[model samples]
Target chain A: MNDIYLDNNATTKCDPLVVEAMLPFFTEQFGNPSSLHSFGNKVGLALKNARKSVQKLIGAEHDSEIIFTSCGSESDSTAIMSALKAQPNRTEIITTVVEHPAVLNLCEYLETEGYTIHKLKVDGKGNLDMDEYKSLLSDNVAIVSVMWANNETGTIFPVEEMAELADEAGVVFHTDAVQAVGKLPIDLENSAIHMLSISGHKLHAPKGVGVLYLKRGVRFRPLLRGGHQERGRRAGTENVASIVGLGVAAELALQNMEHENTVVKAMRDRLQEGILAAVPNAFVTGNPDNRLPNTANIAFEYIEGEAILLLMNKMGIAASSGSACTSGSLEPSHVMKAMGIPYTAAHGTVRFSLSRYNTMEEVERVIEAVPPIVAKLRKLSPYWGESGPVENPEQAFAPVYA
Target chain B: MWDYSETVKEHFYNPKNAGAIEEANAVGDVGSISCGDALRLTLKVEPETEIILDAGFQTFGCGSAIASSSALTEMVKGKTLDEALKISNQDIADFLDGLPPEKMHCSVMGREALQAAVANYRGEEWVDDHEEGALVCKCFAIDEVMIRDTIRENNLSSVQDVTNYTKAGGGCSSCHEGIENILMEEMQARGETFMPGAIQKKKAKPAAQPLVTLETPEPAAAPAAGGMSAFQRYKKIEEVIEKVRPNLQADRGDCELLDIDGKNIYVSLVGACSGCQMAAMTVGGIQQKMIEALGEFVKIIPVDKAQYAAQLAQKQATASA
Candidate 1:
């Protein structure tokens, strides 16, 4: 009955356990982690345990590989820049078209700074073209930064395969796992990924803290030069509380991985399935089976996403779209556009990212509430009148049913 | 967001008089569904006296379009042609308590529909024969009389000039030409067109001097009865710009005095400033600093990229001097 949050992709509520882990560092254990005092040692120990938890979550071989930064963006920036700095002799970087702006924008800046950039494309369902991705990797390419999951579509990428290809090409591989971590299982030991970025806020931890998992024996350079914190890799006073929260959340996520994969995926499937059954023209976006279990992106033809979002807000449901951001901009979603989704359907797309806390009752509520709203909006849409509301319940049910 | 007024939203959701008449004597159609907004107005006219018997509309657009059409229907339901002809865009906006300035064109559209309907009822041939007489904003097909009445009622003096005028450039951007034509015509009618466009360009450009002394008369006091609220400051700026227009024309220089903040009035130095070295001095020192000092609510911003070019010209002139 309370506001149903479907925008888990944007951010998540901090879990109570994570909050409890963070409480002491804010006051009782508020010592400069670097200072030579018992107080500092006590907090320093907490930081170590947090790092260990993060390391264990990703199955990293060493705790030293877990480097903490302010957020996912900073982690991504550090990874890309540090790789290029370590290999200054190389001037080329390869990445995919569907990367987050944190990587894409930085890549744009790098291109302007004389770095040759290669962007791989995605298919109509937002799956990256691995054949093209393989061809683009070469000796001159110093770094490869691809997202483990597309933020808008929740399409999981072949990071392991890509990492293997990059390794053969002598390139440093990095995946922005901001949307993938916790939602999917990640085992660095079994994967060729040399570096991966994860943010606290995407899971159930507070913002302003993130982790960059850099494999041992990897050469890198630090972005900022000041303190000895983060093993001389990053030089800033630690966000002790948020870091603690992120560690606790990561540990909890590791513990819940199995249950979440099944339970959360079921809820996602139920909601996506129900909407397609009720609404006339609803279709899920991205690779239907390969996507994150908690994400469901659907396009209800003929209605604008902002209008749907507004109406959903009235009904206490929160969802997002790629369209509203595109209207005033020439740059549509690099992910959607690369997939060649027609502009009409691209603008009407809505993304629903669920969290583990979401329940079947909430899924049922959404199934009950969403169709009529879509029907109402369709009445006001010019597109709907032209197509005539996709009549015949059999025709409406055929895609999902068949 | 379009900065929509509450009135616009209300009428959009619960339009007062929607739908069409079964046997309508006259109909007015404005805009298209694909153009972002449209209104189809229908009215039954009493043939003997040419008074509207009933009025209704169906609009496909934003809240402002729906509201404007709804207000138009209400305004002309039982009025004669002359009375309805006098219904300006502002009257519809006022009827709905007010629309955002950019959306004033929606009201203009509504008025256009009513006028077109009445014109159609009175014989479209008659209205067409008096093309110049009707005084239309050729771009949006808005009439001259409505613009004059809007200015008088709104105490407007400038063409940045638009607020709540319908049928003007709201979408698709093609109607902008007509709006500009209407604006020039309005200025000409007010005897404000001393030397427009190339006429001023034909005058020889004066070489820039170090001490470019400007003679600006203190702006005339605005009509106090209209209230000196910050909202009305734009009208006062309009008056000041008009007074300064003649001097700018005679000097063969193009300058725009923009009201950035109600308190700051900025005069951008153009022409020679286009290539002047003192462009920053003109923008920061002369324009911005001066404008901010003018009114408590005013802040001036100079868009002149040619400030340095003007300074270089002035420096050359000073060396010659």
Candidate 2:
């Protein structure tokens, strides 16, 4: 375990209670839900209960609305692929550039197969361009898949409004709510979103399990086809243990949503403010007023993000970076590039995502450790002089990339 | 998360020469904030002997970049300007116990900084730009010459290898075809061929001839500091051989370095490489690396392992007499 972990957006620690709930399913109660025997019937009853737990957590009208998949990526792929397969005539997709690669990469692949993919741009604050988004919507579009909260910046898109607009255009809407499922209050029963995706691991459940909340009346097609599991909506024998763990995690998420918005959010805000106060040429990198309560992306100009992350790791702090080096590319993130963030700050962005388990003490330790590391790196920066931080990186070093 | 070596980690934590020298006579800076890594290398050269007295570095990059810069500064100190110019990016990686392939570009950055610093001391012009129509990977702004040089230096066989060393085709991947053409061109020039999905399939024309018209030949008068000089060209063969040594060793194969005479290099492929069919590819790769290293092409003269051993014994006897 790290002394301080601020990478909840990547993955969270599995809750012990959720692990305990999964243990029985893995050991003694390992019968297949498909069998007609008493052992199978008992497991089927547990499966139904887990589905109901997920339904209550997301405020779905029926337990059957939640279809279990392997992970968030699988859920996202199913949602987007099902929408396009359900309607063959609509050969276009409308999405945002700031979407997680699960959606963006799929859309790009679909483009090669003759589907017109319109990727909406984002502003400097990581907010989607609403006018372009509105203009791109049409009956020709099969689906509009945008992330509810960006995994990198935590900037929440107006997915609800977009979903309603897509609905009016006679299109299915899917939002990759992998980051927003537990942190925010979601009422899928009363929402216009045709489908929503969730990952169990993001909310302190075991990995390899996810929920695809398909509205009761929405037309659907399964991405996987093997067994009659999930009412022929999804396939393969269920990941029974992980599904049980996910159910407990969902219940816990419902219980902790209030604490997440207040306590965890306060710690995140303090860590953001403290780092900014001590470091120069640094600023938050999202729609600060309307983002996830737990995520804060801070960019410090001139110095690169990977260096900062390594130094912080040395100090027993775990975090993440938006730099290209982290992603095994020669350029920064697609989200940072799409936002047109200045070159100086874009490559230097660091993301800190908090969980309800984090505390003010860990936040304070991070605040104290960051300032000195930044100063030390600045002193070693070629672009940084004794005076002020580098204002324009492009001027000092030519030939930059997006 | 990056599988960095202990030496790299030590250098990152306690970088030997981490700051700038106020009155340094020679200074060379490469990369920019926009490029995601930058380095400013300062050197104090002893004027009459042209020997480096001291060195310092300020690097803005990842941990490996910092470690590479630190290793470069240490390696160059006390060496003459001529000797310093011979240090390849591979030498920097070797000094720090080798870097991951993905982080190999950091060592390349260090080599560029050293060249700039040496050129600065000699009052020669150094460049950061490519000529018009020379850019290959536009997203990273890496040009054709740099890509070719890196492919040769690292024995890179694919677009992914090129990106790992020089970051040329690691962008939007539009230039992947351009890089593949270059790879094919370089491979054919050395007579090495593979048949991975028609990648190494021979064309009807002279195989050595470039298949694509997109690549512009390296300019006759290459940029002073940015381009390879005679020393760098001469050193490249040894570096190329050294770079492939471990891979050969891994398979219980090896090569004995004997002599270099103009366009012909004499070597005895030993161990598993002695009479193996795949050694043909290794020989082709060595020649290909040299062809790109120096603008002119070279060939390898395969001396049998037994014959070379006899020749070495005869030479030793003659020296004693």
What is the overall TM-score of model 1 with all chains considered together? 0.65
Candidate of highest lDDT: 2
> Poorest 10 consecutive residues of model 2 chain A by lDDT?
A393-402
Across residues A276-368, which tens digit of lDDT does each residue of candidate 1 receive? 998877788788978998899897765556556656776899888765332333223556667776544565678999998888999999999
Q: Which candidate is the best by TM-score?
A: 2
Q: What is the TM-score of each predicted model, taking all chains together? A: 0.65, 0.78
Q: What's the CA RMSD for each of the models?
A: 14.8, 11.9
Chain B TM-scores, listed for every candidate in order, come to 0.44, 0.49
Docking class of 1: incorrect
lDDT value, candidate 1, whole model: 0.72
Candidate 1's displacement at residue A20, Å, is 1.6
CAPRI verdict (incorrect, acceptable, medium, high) for model 2:
acceptable
Calculate DockQ per candidate and list them. Answer: 0.04, 0.25
lDDT of 2 by residue, A278-315 (tens): 99889999899989999999998878899899999989
The per-residue C-alpha lDDT of model 1 at residue B153 equals 62
